[model samples]
Target: MKERNHTTLTEFILLGFGSGLGLKEGPFVVFLVIYMTTTLGNTTMVFLISANSPLHISMYFFLMNLSFLDLCYSSTIAPKAMMSFLAGSKSISFHGCATQLFFFGLFASTEAFILAAMAYDRYTAICNPLLYPITMSKQVCIQLLVGSYVCGGVNSMVQTVFTFTLCFCGSNEIDHFFCDIPPLLSLSCTNTDINVLVLFTLSSLIIVSTSMVILVSYACIISAILRIRSAEGRHRAFSTCTSHMMSVILFYGTLTFIYAQPSSLSAPAQSKMVSVFYTLVIPMLNPLIYSLRNKDVREALGRTISSVFLK
Candidate 1:
């Protein structure tokens, strides 16, 4: 048994999806395409919601924020991953890893809470249409947005501080593409019992609490929808939530599978595959799902394009 000071470690070899898989070069092209689509799609969505007056309500407001987050956090991961591949260098500096982890956690946690807030927005809109405006007011919306970001920032700081504080072995080779808790934990030379505890505990606290909010809100919403007498009314009511539900399933499902389990890093190959889903695929899919499913978004997009062309 031998070791060196974690401080002496200047860089980490990010063996993304292992050494012999040939993932670095082959996936570069695919990830580049996905990253482009994610950027274009989310940017278009944010612009569409902001520029249009009709999409100014609570749901779209949350959606716009979600798009911005997806754009931001996806940029945090994808560009770095692609750059490392392009440079043909697996080494990421200590500060770079810290920065990547911070922004990734910040946006990811914020997006979790934002999804919860969106669920509550849907609940208010569908369950209590009469008081929807009063309940999810502009002031309240701002408060929720600020609260989500703050909570996420706090979580990010905690994870970053604790993670970097740990004594890592001299190997400095991370098993995955990005700097994540589980993979980083695998690098620690010291006992990581407390680290693992904090990781899973915070993960559960954020994921479960937000998930409960989404689940409970949707439950009440379902009850309210059932109470509607007209078939068209029920159908229309459920339609508003369908896109959010899909986003929820995809986003939360992957997150929970990865972070919610403490032993996630144990299965490096599987975790890396799933990481691709949330990191690359989900961001790319969100706007497509929303715009394709929701009539108002499609109509708004159409009108925006038409106005652009007419000028």
Candidate 2:
């Protein structure tokens, strides 16, 4: 028979909003506005990508997936976070917390892999223009996306299982807004060496693997750009990947701050702020970065808006 080391945690109290002194309506309203914007922005990107013929390529397909993930990901926490601010009760049940952690990990990791896939797409499009369509065929694109999701699913399953295995006989208050693995692990009464090692290993794999792919793809892209003789061509080529590069930077930077370290490394307040960047700010920024900065997406949105209004 298999044995478990720690008694399982039944529930966890979330320590959202840090301090609840006079934060009655303002913060709630602000988050509500932010959540609404997140939904609208991400939804618009998905709809535009699906409806526009030009955006039916591999790059836009991945962008649509990222948009979908961002929308659902933000929905998971922002509403509840706002509710916690208003209700002054930050408690989340054991099952509920686990559920949150599962989807959160699922989407966050998926985004990392999706960004890597997008980089590969860009690399093929620019570095091997003749073979772009052949290399990024429909079947290949589907597999890349499906593989990203599968990676996320497997990682989430392992991390979530190991996370919930810890005994929570003592404090239930999670020091962050959500049921993150780090903060939850910090509160466990049992030995978490295995969980910590597994988490660190899994996170390292995701971060390093995707970062390496992005770096290699960009290296090829730079080589292609340097070979082009026309200054106008170079500018146009570089502009194509600008928004995607920005999104990658924001997503990876925030993720590194949150997961790529031991809990002992960060102060509570600093951790909370970094968490807010990945959870709140990055999701909000991604759709905006793509839609506003990229002319093709902006034009697609305009056409969609006109068509809908005309009907």
By TM-score, the best candidate is 1
Candidate with top lDDT is 1
Question: Can you give the TM-score per candidate against the true fold?
Answer: 0.97, 0.94
User: How well is each residue in 201-308 modelled by candidate 1, as lDDT tens digits?
Assistant: 999999999999999999999999999999999999999999999999999899988988867768789999999999999999999999999999999999999999
Off by over 4 Å in 1: 1-3, 20-23
Q: When superposed on Cα atoms, how far off is each prediction in RMSD?
A: 1.6, 2.7
Question: In candidate 2, what are the lDDT values of residues 116-155, reduced to their tens digit?
Answer: 9999999999998999999999999999999999999999
Error of 2 at 14 (Å): 1.2
Q: What TM-score does prediction 2 earn?
A: 0.94
The residue-level lDDT of candidate 2 at 29 comes to 83
Q: Could you tell me which residue pairs clash in candidate 2?
A: none
Task: Quote the lDDT for 136 in model 1.
Answer: 99
What's the lDDT for residue 269 in model 1? Answer: 90
* Number of clashes recorded per candidate: 0, 0
Error of 1 at 47 (Å): 0.5
For candidate 2, the per-residue lDDT at 144 reads 98
